[model samples]
Target: MTSNTEVFPVLETKRLVLREITKKDANSILDYLSDAEVMKYYGLDPFNSLDNALDEIAWYQSIYSNKTGIRWGITLKEQGVVIGSCGFHNTVSQHSRTEIGFELSKGQWGKGIAAEAVEAIINYGFKHMHLQRIEALIEPPNLSSQRLVEKIGFVREGLLRNYEFTRGKFDDLYMYSLLKQDLDKINSM
Candidate 1:
């Protein structure tokens, strides 16, 4: 097996391919941004225009290439479309510890794509990023996301009171995490 520290161009899965974001993916990302239902829990205003979306996509790609920590865009394998974005987030102490986040298209919900993407990113984190622990900060209104994290084996550490200003006001966020050792054991089975 390869060491858990090698960075690759992309990590391919059965249904999705984990890769860096691109300029061309801006419009699809805007699709996700336009949906009020999609952004309801994410705590962000709608993208004003395609240019705004393009700027966001460019930001993700440029920072990633420069090694700045942020979320990654999730692309569908067969369709080659940007259905959502998910990746390492919330850099604390220069990436020594960071959180994991994912957002998918409303059309693709309930298909386990988020889990698959999270699994791939988790493997990437453990194998390549030297990430000791991966955190998932979820909103209280989002029970489905909480379930997804639990199903992926992340333990609910506790509730962070007024941790994030989401959906307008400060919301108590749930902290969920998984260790690299636990991933090693889980994947070994």
Candidate 2:
């Protein structure tokens, strides 16, 4: 495996392009992130302004620069506008592991776009980031996210009761993971 820190990796799927998000995309990011329905199970309150979106984009850049994580803006091939974002965070190189997070605009949900984009990044994590395990933390109420990860081969490890404080309360989360060996098994099948 090779690690090149200079170039931001851009990923592509059948219908989407996963690329670095610029300040120009803040409005698009705001559109979905501000929606209470989109933020319901996301652990954070909906974004209230463009600055919130800018701050988010900055966090993405900070993670990449610190070599701790990477996030990609999800855009349709035909539209070139960010509808959402997805990627890994809480990366621990020593442990060969990382946590995945993602969100999509309401219009894009149920279109399999999340699955396709997530699968691309999972492969990248294993083959390029040299990760042994990728994890997803899902709120119990987020059934769609749970299903998305399971469909991509992540197994539900267990429920961590009140594991995190979010949205003004402690929330229960289900931990799910996909190991490199697990992906190998999936690919061979």
- Identify the leading candidate in terms of lDDT: 2
lDDT of all predictions = 0.77, 0.90
Please, what are the lDDT tens digits per residue for candidate 1 over residues 73-124?
Answer: 6778877888898887555545556788788999999998998888888887
lDDT by residue for model 2 over 1-189, one digit each (tens)?
114358888999889999998899999999999999999988778999999999999889888887889999999998999998999999999999999999999999999999888998998899999999999999988999998888778899999999999878999999999999888644542
Colliding pairs, model 1: 4-127
Superposed Cα deviation of residue 40, candidate 1 (Å) = 1.2
Kindly report the root-mean-square deviation of model 2 from the true structure over all alpha carbons: 2.9
Compared with the true structure, the alpha-carbon lDDT of candidate 2 equals 0.90
